[model samples]
Target: MNQDPLQNLRLSHPAHFLALGFGSGLSPVAPGTMGTLVTLPLVWLLAFSGQTGYLLVTLLACVAGVWICGRTARDMGVHDHGAIVWDEVAGMLLTMIAVPVNWLTLLVGFLLFRMLDIFKPWPISYLDKHVHGGAGIMADDILAGVVACGLLHLLIFIGWLPVPAL
Candidate 1:
């Protein structure tokens, strides 16, 4: 009889809890997507603090994620395991920075971030390949968020997407 490998991971551990995206990363499906989806409410709430606060929170998450993800990965004996997704949470927050928190923006930002993260084009791919540890796990998703944020802003600037009055 085969036991589930993840059963050994204790969600009670703070690093494991966070790195697993509050358990959303344990989903049998696309855990990364689930992790990103679970972060939408956080993004919306942070939007109330305005861009500066949002950026600050995102920065903090990114910084802490290095340890959170790294610790969990070490425990799991896998680098950047599919079950660790704090990076996705941080990436989604970064993607939503300065953007109005509405269903549309949320959807677009989620899709864009996921796309960049999944595709890992150019520098993102390069960093993911060369980097290691918690920072290595986060580098690709962070870059994806940055690119998606830029694309999202461009969409609004070009009038392809409207900036709803806040």
Candidate 2:
């Protein structure tokens, strides 16, 4: 079985490329955070088109990520390998759905999403443990994104994080 996933970086398979976050997942440390950071600029650009467009793109990315992550994980003979970070990218996108395109909001969203993803609170933890396959790998982070989204919105609602006027 293929255990060394680093070999995927050399192969030009689209799924591998995407699942690896276009090489951001190669980081020796905190690859998930790196993948999420890599998503910031893309999310910023997507935000230019407004929330509906961003939501549409994020939904599409999540759908595509299921296949990409699953194939990459299968090739590596593992489930949710550390290097498969397309889930992070998709999750970050989902997290920013309600956030305004401000650096502070982005940073806060990043931190919150990372925390929720790592800590795996409540149902997020439950799903992370119980879910299987690509969907399983993606579900926890997606829910993390949801939690982060709620927190960011709550902060905004309470005047803790200012929402820049669009």
Candidate 3:
């Protein structure tokens, strides 16, 4: 019997690619970390589209991703497993909003978002543990995005970051 822990997210499935974070979730080790890294390039490219486009795309992805992730997880028979990383993709996209399309800001946002995501501070942690189904899978990342947005603003306010040119 084949005993791979997370097989439902097949690369052949388009939903899997979107939900598993463009195949980053397929990494044998540290899939969550890999998912975040995989998103950096996409995020960087999207950042060039300006704040409006960035926000719209991220919002759309998040709204659609919940279902894709939920159904894919159910198909794979795993519940919010690390390999299902659409939430990370959507959250990372959200973090790019209103931030400069530069390496420094990307690095900062990536580090901060990943930290909040993994640590699941306060209400974020609460949501992750309590919510069920796709909402549960997506909620924690949404909170992380909120925290990242706040931090990005703070960094800009302190002159540590530059406002993106629309």
Candidate 4:
């Protein structure tokens, strides 16, 4: 693509700032992973308020992300530019829902979410290919989060994944 993802930052658009994960997405390498890493602390902090608070924050983020991502992509004139990583933040937040916020669970959730996102299994792959615009940008990642969440819960149920006392 000829378009520079940084153009919005140069222009100082608020939507670009948020959609870029507050600059984490500007990383030259693995911006999405960087975005998730940046999001971890925010999620950790939110977790202190308990699950209800975490869920509320995550819901708000997801809702805001659709608009932010959409606007940033429009500004960049690119569809789901690699630099727009708010979707990663929302996905990671969704992945962590009810999964406990300890280091181990965070690590597992991150790995699982990244794998499902990268591989894009079945309907996730279908959505990634078929969907468009901001919702499309967010859809596959959200589904990956759902898949990761379910797997984490299953592991907990089987007693394979021990939930550490927070």
Tell me the spans in candidate 4 whose CA falls farther than 4 Å from its real position: 1-3, 10-12
Rank the models by TM-score, top first.
1, 2, 4, 3
TM-score of 1: 0.95
lDDT of 1: 0.92
Where does candidate 3 clash, by residue pair?
A: none
Reference-based TM-score of each model: 0.95, 0.94, 0.91, 0.93
* Clashing pairs counted in every model: 0, 0, 0, 0
> lDDT by residue for model 1 over 1-166, one digit each (tens)?
8655577589999899999999999999999999999999999899899778888999999999999998888887788989999999999998988887789999999999999999899999998999999999999999999999999999988999887775
Output the TM-score of candidate 3.
0.91
Q: What is the lDDT of residue 92 in candidate 4?
A: 93
Clashing pairs in 4: none
lDDT of each: 0.92, 0.89, 0.84, 0.87
Cα lDDT of model 3 overall?
0.84
Name the top lDDT candidate: 1
CA shift of 110, model 1, Å: 0.5
Compose the digit string of candidate 3's lDDT tens values, residues 1-166. Answer: 8656565457778877788888888788978878888989988888778778878888888898889888888887878878898898888888777777678888888998899998999999999989989888998998898789789879988987875564
